[model samples]
Target: MVRGKTQMRRIENATSRQVTFSKRRNGLLKKAFELSVLCDAELALIIFSSRGKLYEFSSSSMQATVGRYLRHTRSDQSHHLDQPLPHQHDLQAVQNEAASLLKEIESVEVSKRKLLGESLGTSSYEELQQLEQQLERSLSHIRARKHEVYREQIEQLKEKYDVEEERQQSPTQIQLAEVSPNYGESSSISDVETDLFIGPPKSRSK
Candidate 1:
């Protein structure tokens, strides 16, 4: 039978747990030693057991190796030393920003009035021409959009008329309108019936 893979979890039995820990720890240390010697690499391995016992191996002095690692890791951080770290804007910076925004608002308000034909005294001939062109372009776009809306309304009305015409049609109602064909025609007094007076003032009393 094929052997099942060893389950990678905490060993429940105390004796088995201790045995596994000792065997794995020794194997790990041996592997680290072989890796350092065969490849001639600087290596560090630090392990702490459940009982607080320390196991450490370093190719060089542990402190020196750790210090060298720190130096390499922090090399990029050296450039940041002279640069100011990010923080909230101070009072002076906020004031300056507010002043800049106020000036921008004033400029925008002036431009808005100029577009409405209010402020023309300060505008040059070129500025006036530019404004005129801008207004004409805006008007063209507005008119195009208006025409599109008009077409949509016409289509809706056409569809509505078609529906109403269909509703008025029936199997018996051949080529007839919903309203009377001779609805507004007037008949002479002699052709009309006496009881069905068309426009006699006496009908109002009834």
Candidate 2:
């Protein structure tokens, strides 16, 4: 027959309660003895009844077992206390680095504001002079670059003019060569005609 599971509550009758306590206490002690014997374990159990009656079991000396349990718990707590948390140092380092970077960024922002003429009231005369000198140097560099650009442009224009002049005079030179019978035979006529028609070559001035 399948017996229904019993619902546990306090036994209201004092006599029944005492009887149940005696039976369960004996049963628990028997189980503890069996477990120690079967598993060859060091074990201890202790109980006190409502009337202050003591019930106890121990595979070895109860004092020794209790002492060992206390020592084990204390050592575990001490070990945890001694060791640092894994992230503590890393978190501190990251915080320090962040603070340093923040300071650098603020300094750069202040300098940028000064350069933009936004913080002029706070600047000293020496600082103003330094800024003025820096600006003058920058202006000088810009003017030098502008002059270099203009010189390059003029040189390019001069090259283009020389090329066009050569192109235009090429056909005329060819026609003159064909018309003059002694153009290639003798140098006298060619030299005289060159000087008379084109004039002596102009010397370049430094």
lDDT of each: 0.87, 0.89
> What TM-score does prediction 2 earn?
0.42
lDDT of 1 by residue, 94-202 (tens): 8899999999999999999999899799899999999999999999999999999999999999999999998887856663464456555533334764665577788
Model 1 residue 175 CA deviation in Å: 11
Pairs of residues at least 3 apart in sequence or in different chains that clash in candidate 2: none
lDDT (C-alpha) at residue 153 in model 1? 100
Cα RMSD to the true fold for all candidates: 16.9, 22.4
Off by over 4 Å in 1: 1-31, 46-54, 60-123, 174-206
Best by lDDT: 2
